[model samples]
Target: MPNAAPAPGQQPAAPLLGIGQVLARLTTEFPDLTPSKLRFLEERGLVHPARTPSGYRKFSQNDLSRLKLILTMQRDCYLPLAVIKDYLADVDAGLNPPMPGAALPGGASILQTGRRLSREELTREAGATPMLVQDAFSASVITPAETYGEDSLIVLKALVELQRSGIEPRHLRGFRQAAERELGLIESALMPVARRRDPSSRVKAAELAVEIAGQLEVVRSSLIRSALSRIVP
Candidate 1:
């Protein structure tokens, strides 16, 4: 459960860290973190650090932990801030909600433990051959990278399974085209937000893009399921 706010007329607990100290502690893990980004997260209501007498922000231990979880989810899971905010709301309410983008409840915490893998390690871990990985790259299914993250590993593993059903990476080339079309739709939807020249607007636009993509996924999955039902019946 999350820490409760102090009652009226009560001061927050001692030993809170200022924004600079918090940055010092977290910058190594999150190299892109900046004071403005921290402020942006606060503005998004992901963290509610207490205020000092002079109106400065002071983060408690709980605030620091929450920030870490939020950042980890963003970095590892690529989840939208809205989704993460909803998941954290459940946690604060004392519910054991499943992590977003995870396959199952109680599967893993939002904090990922896996490191990026080289091409060889990626194929080995996915039980796929180098040829298949190359095909995925050729088909634009997976971006060519010197080191692959968990998302690439998951895609390669799925491709390996699909291969057993005689579906090769080349057979899925249309998926890349479909993704490009969906991206076009997202970009169109974000045009108004993108027209703004402010940094916060850019942040909002990015989050909105992910949320739109998630909605598109839901529609795409439903269409697939509907099509499958006709064939299976």
Candidate 2:
């Protein structure tokens, strides 16, 4: 009965509950969540709970808070797993805290304001050369568009920062390959729905891909943070 809900008046100092109790609290918010899914998340290193003497996992308050943040990102932002991981890492390092838009249900921003500049304007604003832009395009890190989107502007800004570190566009070629692989996974997941060719199906597939990507990002970020923990403390 892993999915069984807890009965009323359980002991407050229990300090640990099996997977069933954890789901009882969490499933109300995350309807599609299941034991297997939670295990999948753990397998990817997104979550780590204390093990009981009998080896059953016992989640804590901190684990709940972190799960809330991870789920919020997935339900809201359509960011890729790698990007989400980088963002969570920033927050763990006390750099970028979670945005208000990320916390409220269905409050995700389109992230449109960040792209106020046109491509030409972005190049001027970022102080990046045409060659750099071309390099980014060639690497498939930024797709060709009639106009560069807000994301493109962010990439350009990132490149500017990297330039200060003596890193050039060529150094990021592997990034494009990684992006392709992730996109392939998304496409494969969407294939069944995508074949339907209905507007709703298309929208659903896009949203699902975005959420999956966000979850993957959270997992990646958590793994990196765990690696850094030994030296950080």
Candidate 3:
């Protein structure tokens, strides 16, 4: 099928790939991916491939990159589609948004470089001892993974610094409990949206969950800052 021409005032470019071609390129990396999944992602507003004259979906190079990034985040990071959509929105607006759970540097877009480090590499890069990593794992501070992402490295590095202050992972075990409590609060708040159970409502519920989590984080940080101020003075 011939690709559609660029719209008025739009720059003409290379030919776009049909759905089968897109799948051919991506299936090796994401075997579980299928046409329905791609359509679902589009419905969720994560990626918008152009429509051909006969209404076939044709993906551009940019769309392919975006799909790769989305799939990678879901597969590797276990991030929800809603969170991924928010991150992609920031990227589309030309903002260098940090990865969903990681405070990476502005220039380090995971979309540009899908970096996955082995266990040994993660420990070495974070300058963390194996014991510390084990403790963190035991404390549920970091989930065990064969290959860790940048977020894991960031967490390990922070733990290493905290260890010097005599704050071991065991001391922060309650953090996981606190997180679960906050998650419970989110789930409770989303009950209204969740009751609908339709596709659109499901998407809305997911997005609302992210928004609620962000607000909870703000409150949590404020409380911590308030507590620290009393101790420092």
Candidate 4:
């Protein structure tokens, strides 16, 4: 994590953020944001909203902007929190986010901003039960998130439909393996840039990993289901 900001030039200290203000600001964008979840992000080093004399957090406008960027990447891009943390690290250092677009070196567009969804909203929209969603995580099909993004909801929704046809979360455990293999490929491909330790490159590496993994999942699931169909009644 970055070092704490120098005490604002010794000027009069700014007001701290109470729970309600923090909730009110973040809730509009991250509807599932709770005090626990915010604390979790802080614990992970993703955000460092300043603390007041009473220890209440006081998020500056910059803090709010950074939070928006992080949530956008998570929900829209399906990036794991670790990767998102790396990207934000770049931003904090005044470096551009590494992703597809003219902003970074790679010509890929995979790092575009995206919308996110809350867990409850995702379950309801995807017509999935909470148990099934939890099972996905338990089976290593999906990771836990403070708020699931749209892609996650879409995947869960599709899985729910598949479950109706007798496919279980355990059946998709291979998906995790297939995904790891694809990530291995992307990592190798990006090693030249990734080895430099540039925050932008790291972000790019992460974005590429997610994009390829998503594609690999689609193909692997389709091929397996198709092959099974021939033997099944």
Sort by lDDT, best first: 1, 3, 4, 2
C-alpha TM-scores of all predictions: 0.56, 0.51, 0.54, 0.42
For model 3 the TM-score comes to 0.54
Poorest stretch of ten by lDDT in candidate 1: 105-114
Residues 1-233, candidate 1: write the lDDT tens digits.
99999999998876999999999999888766778778867866789999989999999999999999988777666677776898899999999987776644467544353367999999999999999999999999999987887778989999999999999999999999999999899999999999999976776676567656766776788899999999998
Error of 3 at 221 (Å): 0.8
Better of 1 and 2 by TM-score: 1
What are the per-residue Cα lDDT tens digits for candidate 4 across 1-233?
Answer: 98567686766545556667878988876665677656656766888888878787778767777777766676556566666776777877899855522233354344444346788888889899999999998888878988776568768988998899999998999878866777678778768867878665665566555544545555667898999999894
> In model 2, which regions exceed 4 Å deviation?
1-14, 40-46, 52-56, 77-79, 82-87, 94-110, 115-132, 144-185, 191-207, 210-233
Q: Report lDDT (CA) for all predictions.
A: 0.85, 0.70, 0.83, 0.72
Per-candidate clashes, comma-separated: 0, 1, 0, 1
lDDT of 2 by residue, 1-233 (tens): 46555668774444656688888888887665677766666765677889879888888877777776666665555454445565667777888555523434464354533335566787887788888878777767677776666567878889988888998888888987777788888788878988998765665565577656756676667998999998798
Clashing pairs in 3: none
Best by TM-score: 1
What is the per-residue lDDT of model 3 for residues 1-233, given as tens digits with 9 covering 90 to 100?
99897899998886799989999999998776688778767866889999978999999999999999988777655576766987888888899967865524775545435778999999999999999999999999999987887778889999999999999999999999999999899999989989996875675565567546755765777899999999997
Scored by lDDT, model 4 comes in at: 0.72
Q: Which 10 successive residues of model 3 have the least lDDT summed?
A: 103-112
Relative to the unseen true structure, what is the C-alpha lDDT of residue 38 in candidate 2, on a scale of 0 to 100?
69
In candidate 1, the residue pairs with backbone N, CA or C atoms under 3 Å apart (3 or more residues apart, or in different chains) clash, namely none
lDDT of 3 at 224: 94
